[model samples]
Target: MQSRGRYHRTVLLVLVRTVWIAVCAAVLVVSGIAWSTVSTISNGVERSFAIPEDAPRSSSGRNILIMGLTTRLDLHGEPLPDDVLRRMQAGESDRGGYNANTLILLHIPASGPAIAMSVPRDNLVPLSSGGEGKIKEAYGRAKVAEEERLQAAGQHDKRTLERAGREAGRRAQVQTVATFLNQPIDHLVEISLIGFFHIAEGLGGVDVCLKNATKDPLSGADFPAGRQHLDAGQSLSFVRQRHGLPNGDLDRTKRQQAFLSAVARRLKGADVSAMQAMIDMAKQDVVLDSRFDLADFARNVPTEVRFETLPVEGGARVDGLDVNKVDPEKVRKKVTELAKEPPPPPSNDGIPCID
Candidate 1:
């Protein structure tokens, strides 16, 4: 009887071990599937952009320009109404022109965290052509000129508008921002204003923290202190508000950086099941330059990337508009500092947008 009991006990132990092994194997398979799905969704959203294959490999690393086009061609190829266009052309009050309100330059070093620099839209800089204007105006002017030419040639208005918008996006803005970088910018990513809102909504909104109370009628943003979860419309207004910010454009640029950081954090936290939500968001309101391949890149971007903003001083104004003029000597020095192998820690505070 004792021998039989021992045999039965041993058999039961073996069975339990086998079951545990099977459970572990199943768990692993499910985890892998989930990870893959998340990666695919993220890449799909980003793949619309055109990333150059032969982009120069940097020993120190490469830079990417994340441009937000102010044109009405968000994901749906929608154009602004004629009345709105007329008001914008006449420089009427409250009419935001077709110009890039946000410009961010991302410097990804071969090693360490990525640095993001924001350029204020009102920055006064000499254009490639003689004379100075708001940096945002360059692309808008190019777009307007292209449309006028197409109209004069008696082309189909819709088709011509589409072509003109594309040309304006590629030639006027992206190229101009690259030129301003004064360094070899390897990749360019353009995201429309609507794209940002859709992405936020898709992710179930983003949490934003304001150090103080703020209100801006122009951007329709109103917030009172502390952490607040913002939906799509609120998120857009939060990042767009500039009038009430104490530092004007400088403060707005900082808010944008904070918002992007929050977004990156939120995306990293999303589970594999959220893939559908991501895909829906991309399909609805996102467009990318033709070079990026979402599937491939998504697999490689581990959730450990670091984010930093570009440093700038707010001391100048042009034509009553606040401008964060790039300190050439400071920028050159900073760039050189970044070129060193295993780049140094990012300087905290005083970073602005690259637009």
Candidate 2:
């Protein structure tokens, strides 16, 4: 009983953390408010030039890359305030690097339902940095290299260097995923670990259902089986715990997908005022491509979205690191098949039961 409970809790955390970026986008696109209002709120939101200007876009639909970084630092690469850090329990800023731990490719066509597909972080593939490695490493590797190159060229300003390094990281990550999936990236949304925490807080709390009652001390998750509401901190814990899960990280990934579906359902029912308030709280933590127009994107979005995890052949070790082995051709084919299907009907009631 304890073992199964842990597995469900782990899955919940993984799903929730990975899909925070999608939820952020949903807030912008589903707020059901005036474009001018969205534009006003987004006035000073950070923008990235990761996607190239001349990149070919899908004439049929839009593909958005939602990435979650492992870093605990603020977007500016500075340590978070002590109080905020304490609230997050994310530890000091030095703990994590810029690895893109969560990657979800969301495809929204000119018609039909939107599809949000989660890419496992440990997938071994050819990277934009020139050699093959885990897909998640593309960001940090490029960032470090760019920072070094800049320092060699006599740049000493910490903020300037940090910004430049991160830009390089973003470019590498975008290119890597695009090439892997054989899809053009129409937009990019990047958020850090703290972004996840802020998003959960902004939502007030999220409704989640677990199949088994569980206790995970590491994640501070202790909840009974069945449907329930989790506050910001508890929500984070529910999505972060993988230690006691039966399938470990894989279960967590499944949870992330389920969590996203639940969030989308919640957003669909939210009033414009509530969504606007959440967007205001989240804008600081989000980094969208400069070309992205929230108003325009929101106009075409369908109320229904389906979430899935791309199929992986299995796992193997490369350079002593565990990685998911995936066939690129197979992945592309799967995506094509999914894009052709009609979307499922929107649901507003029961939480997505996860275990």
Candidate 3:
């Protein structure tokens, strides 16, 4: 039982961290907050140079990449507090490395609902770090290489090394995804797994629906069919259950989409004080590109936001690693087609049901 519990917690941490792209956006500038509060929150957020000051702007809209690192470590590479680790049910600092397990691109067009595209982490593609590998590896690969270079250069402080290495990682990750999807990244929002738990806690909890009664020992998800509310831990379990699903990681992607949808709905009716508190929590976990304007985004954010996964040809193995096979041209064309469609109508539906 002890061994099983540890394995469960380990998988729980890995999978749950793969979502929460929504948390960064949804928590940062929910529509009703005061401008002063939004400005303060924006200023308090840690900034990154992943997107360059003179990077080419998107002609039609702004594209923001929200990268969620699988690392169990915090932004500064320190282990999370014991209390936080206990609450997250995650393992010690060694469990997850520096992979960007979750990559979501949000395109806020000049005049319509924003579209969020989720890119599966295991998609095999040419990485900016070197040759072909999982898209998720681009971050860690660049990070390690930069750290090694920095070590040779005599910058030996641990935190300083980690910070510089992470900046390289972020830049590589942003460029890799932009090349893959053929889009310009105007800004970036980076977070670690713990941010998911913190955002959920701020919401007080969330409501999710599953299509069938299910139990997954690996992810620690055991819930009955139909609409059910979950506390922060259970909410993590909710998005983490992919082992028993027919589509595996693909289904997990949909679960993440539904979760963000539910978050958006909840925020619409959330108390002003609660929203402010959530923003406060977010500032601790999120890092945004220096150029992102939170106040303008708060005022102009669309009422309807749509989520979809980038098309993958299928699954394949390369060098003994399982990866999603994606056709780059097909992906770019698909994105172009999606861009041409009119914004989707607002969903009056409540919590979305998922398998």
Candidate maximizing lDDT: 3
Per-residue lDDT of candidate 1, residues 53-129 (tens digit): 56443455656566676544444356644563332232232245467787766655554444555666776655543
Question: In model 2, how large is the Cα lDDT of residue 65?
Answer: 90
TM-score of each: 0.71, 0.86, 0.88
- Clash count (model 2, backbone only): 3
User: Could you give the C-alpha RMSD of every candidate to the true structure, in order shown?
Assistant: 12.4, 8.1, 8.5
Q: For model 1, what is the error of residue 262's alpha carbon versus the real structure, in angstroms, after optimal superposition?
A: 1.9
lDDT of 2 by residue, 4-27 (tens): 433332222222222353443243
Model 3 Cα RMSD, Å? Answer: 8.5
Best by TM-score: 3
Residues 1-355, candidate 3, lDDT per residue (tens digit)? 6554333322221112212335323333322344454466667778888888877778888787888787778888998888887777656777778898778888777886667788988998899877999999999999999999999998899999999999999999999998898888888888887876776776777888889888888767789999988878776766666788878888888877777666655654555454555665566777888887765665555545577788899999898988999999998887877765634644545566788
Clashes in model 2: which pairs? 13-239, 15-255, 15-256
Model 3 segments beyond 4 Å from truth? 1-33, 342-348
Give candidate 1's TM-score: 0.71
lDDT against the true structure, each candidate:
0.53, 0.73, 0.74
* Ranking of models by TM-score: 3, 2, 1
Model 3, residue 184: C-alpha shift (Å) = 0.7
